[model samples]
Target: MTIIFITTFSEVHADLAIIAHPDYQGGELTREMVKELFLEEKLEFPSGHKAIPANHASGSPDRKAFFEYVLEMSETRHKRYWARKVSVGKKGAPKELASHKEVLDWIKNTPLGITYIEKTKVDDSVKVLLTVAVFDDL
Candidate 1:
C-alpha cells in the first residue's frame, strides 16, 4: 500500500480602517499624516484637535500589519525610534490596548482617539480616516 500527503495553503487579506471618535473633527488623514500621528510626531490634527493614537497590543495581527503598512517600519525599528525619542525628552509610543473591542470602546469615549482595526469590525460609532490593505499567509 502507498500513502501520499497533501499540503494546502491559503492567503488572507484584510482592510484595516483607521478610525477616530465621532467627535473628532480632524477629517481624513493622508498616509504620512497617519504615520506621524501614530509615531507621536504630529500631536494635533490640521483642525487643531489633539490626536491621540491608540495601538493594538504587541504581537496582535493588527499591530503587526499597521506597523508594516502604515508606519512603514518594523517593530524593532519602531521600538528603537521611540527609545531615542524618549531619551531626548520626547513623547513615547501610543497607548496600547489588549484587543479591538477595548480600542473601539476607548475611542468611542475619547474625543480624539485614533486607532486601526479590521474594516469589517467597524461600526457606526467611529469615523474611518483611512483604509490599508493587509495580507498574510496561512
Candidate 2:
C-alpha cells in the first residue's frame, strides 16, 4: 500500500496593522492596551472618547490572525467571550465587516473606531497605531 501525506497548512502569514480614525488624538496604544481594547476591558480612549473596535468579518484570515496573535484566542473562544460580555449589557464584539476596503471606509468615517487590517490596505485617512505579525502558531 502506498501512503501519501495530505497536510493542510498554509504559508501565507499576514501582519495586522492597528488603525484608528484620523481624528484620533489618544496616541499609540501599547500591546496590552490593544489587547484590553479588543477584549472589551477598555471602552474609551485615553482622551475619553468612546473606543469603537471594528473588525474584519468572522471568517476573514486577517481576523483570525488578529485574534490569535493579538487577542490570543481562537475564533470560538473569542465569540463566547463577546457573547458573555453582551449578556452583561457591555458592548459585544467589534463590528464585523466584509473586506479591508469596507473596514477602511468605516474607520475613516468613525472618529473613535479602531480596527486591525492588512498593512497594504491602510491609507492616510486612518492613523496606524501599530503593526503586529500574525504567526500561524501560538
Candidate 3:
C-alpha cells in the first residue's frame, strides 16, 4: 500500500493518479474525500496505484480509459472526455503515476506529506483492499 498526505481538509486535492498495477487492486478514488480529510489536521491513507478489480473493469475501449474511470472519476464516462482533450493536444496523455518507490522519494522531502503501508492480501487471488486512516498533522 501507499500513503498520501494532505495538510488541511479544505484544500484542493491532487489527482489520485495510478502509477502501476503490479498487484492489480482496483477501485474508485475521489478528490472530495481527500479534500475533506485534510480538515485542520494531517491525513494519510493506504493508497494504491492500481485498478479496482478485473470484475469491475469498465466497458471502455482502452486501458487508459478504463483506468481513468476506475481510478479517477469513479466511472468510465470521463475517459472519453479526457481522451478528447488528449487528442486535441490540450492535454497530455496521463502516465501511470509512478511506482511506490519513486513516490516515496518524492514524499520524503516534499512539504505535502505521505507514507507507505505494507502491501498485503486476504485471499490468495484477491489483493487486500487498500485502506487507511489519517494521523493528525503537527
Candidate 4:
C-alpha cells in the first residue's frame, strides 16, 4: 500500500496608501494619527476642515489587513466599537465603499475625504499622505 498527501497554500500581502484630497495641506500623519482617523476619533483634518473618511467594506481583504495591521483590531470588534460610539453620539464610522474604485471616486469628489487603499490603486488625482505595509510585522 502507498499513501500520498497534497498541500496547497496561497498568500496575499497588501500595502496601504493613505491618500487625501489634493487641497489637503494638513501635513503628514503619524501611525497613531492614522489609527485615530480610521477609528473616527479624529473628525477634522489638521487644517480644520471636517474629514470624511472613505473606508473599504467590512469583507474586503484590504479592510481586513487595515484592521489587523493599522487599527490592531478585528472586524467584529471594530463594528461593535463604532456602534457604541455612535449610540452615545461620540463618533461615526467611515463611509464604507465596496471597492477601491468607489473609494477613489469618493475621495476625488469629496474635498476633505481621506482613505487608505492598496498602493497600486493610487494615482495622480489624490495626494498621498502616507504608506504603511499591512504585513510589516510578518
Model 1: pairs clashing at backbone N, Cα or C within 3 Å: none
Model 3 scores worst on lDDT over the 10 consecutive residues at 49-58
1 or 4, which is superior by lDDT? 1
TM-score-sorted candidate list, best first = 1, 2, 4, 3
TM-score against native, each model = 0.87, 0.84, 0.26, 0.83
Give the per-residue Cα lDDT of candidate 4 at 74: 96
| lDDT tens readout by residue for model 3, 1-138 | 999986654332222232222343334334343322222111333343321111112342222332332333434444565567668765432223233344333333332232122222112322223233222224
- Mind giving the per-residue lDDT tens digits that candidate 2 earns over 86-109? 898986677888988899899998
Sort order, lDDT high to low: 1, 2, 4, 3
Best by TM-score: 1
The most accurate candidate by lDDT is 1
Q: What lDDT would candidate 3 get against the real structure?
A: 0.32
Q: Where's the lowest-lDDT run of ten residues in candidate 2?
A: 6-15
Q: Model 1, 31-137: lDDT tens per residue?
A: 88999988887899879888889899999988999998899999999899999999999877889999888988999998888899989989999988888888675
lDDT values, one for every candidate: 0.88, 0.84, 0.32, 0.81
Q: List the residue pairs that clash in candidate 2.
A: none
